[model samples]
Target: MATDDGMRLAYYIVLLVVIGGAMLFELSGRGGKALRQLVLWVVIFAGAAFAAELWMNDGLGGRQTITSEGRIEIPASRDGHFHLTARLNGTDVRFIVDTGASSIALGPADARRIGIDPDDLAYVGSAMTANGQVQTAPVTIDELAIGDIVDRNVRAWVIDGELDGSLLGMSYLRTFARVSFENDLLVLER
Candidate 1:
């Protein structure tokens, strides 16, 4: 989050500079083609600069930019359990990349959203929660995805009773080659 804010600030500063440069170009007295040509070039430069930032965020900017310091406040995707906005069956789902959770756990709502029939599953165990004990049932996510990442027939538990949300426990996090957190960006390398 901090990294994102830093990037926003940096971009804003860049925008201010671009505007100032444009104003200066407009004032540069060379009358006809020369001034118009210079103005066009400036616009092109600004557009390219912003486009590059977007590219970097999309992970297409390459590993060099990911590891580069001060390239963009794109939270260091270093090493940590990150809360990445993941895709699941073409829908967005929030998951906590937790290493502590014994098995993947899903909330009742999430289970329903994923096409699981809550009444059909059997409550097998009592899982401990931050609030207290909760019943857990065996369930499988037909499809689980994150960005371009996807996994099918993933094992997870549907807490029989109330649960705050689902957990992307070690079972899932372990599959990645590397999981890191730096600059507020959860970087996953697989």
Candidate 2:
């Protein structure tokens, strides 16, 4: 695991354990404990629910499951990113669904995975990232699919720097008939 990811995991684990233990201790006693216990449980449950929200939002599992209604649902990751697996050019590429991004972004490695030779591409475009300005190369995905959803000839950029993973940006997400998040599920209906 990356150092950043490891640290985040440790942080959450400690937070949940501490909160849970406190809740249990509060529940063990009786008498004046009624309201206290209730409040404590509420706090504990809220903590857990918050953790769940972060997990589902992170999409660390990178798995998208089809619902009974034929919509796509992606649970969040621990770090609160909606990670999903998309088939790019018939090969599986893991992507973080990023609404903030204007278009799809593929890392150098992911560009190669989708059959683009990074070395041959000209990084004529630029995008501002959290790390500052970075060069980008325009590319196209012949096929990008998440669950049963599919888009062809999708426009994207290849990041010149080392990217943790590809980002599923508006270029593809906009194709969805409806996109919403409900009950911790990133719902996409076509």
Top candidate by lDDT: 2
TM-score of each: 0.55, 0.65
Mind giving the per-residue lDDT tens digits that candidate 2 earns over 1-190?
A: 6464698678668777767766666767644767667668767776887668565554355557876565888877667777787789878888889999989999988889879999999999999887889999998789877656677898999999978788888877888789999877798887
Candidate 2 lDDT for residue 63: 56
lDDT of 1 at 8: 70
- Candidate with maximal TM-score: 2
In order of listing, the candidates' clash counts read 9, 10
Q: On residues 37-102, what C-alpha lDDT tens digit does candidate 1 reach at each position?
A: 777687778878767765645433222223222121123333333444555565566666676887
Instruction: Identify the runs in model 1 with alpha carbons over 4 angstroms from their true place.
Output: 1-81
Query: In candidate 1, what residue range of length 10 has the lowest lDDT sum?
Result: 64-73
Candidate 2: deviation at residue 111, Å?
A: 0.8
lDDT of 2 at 23: 69
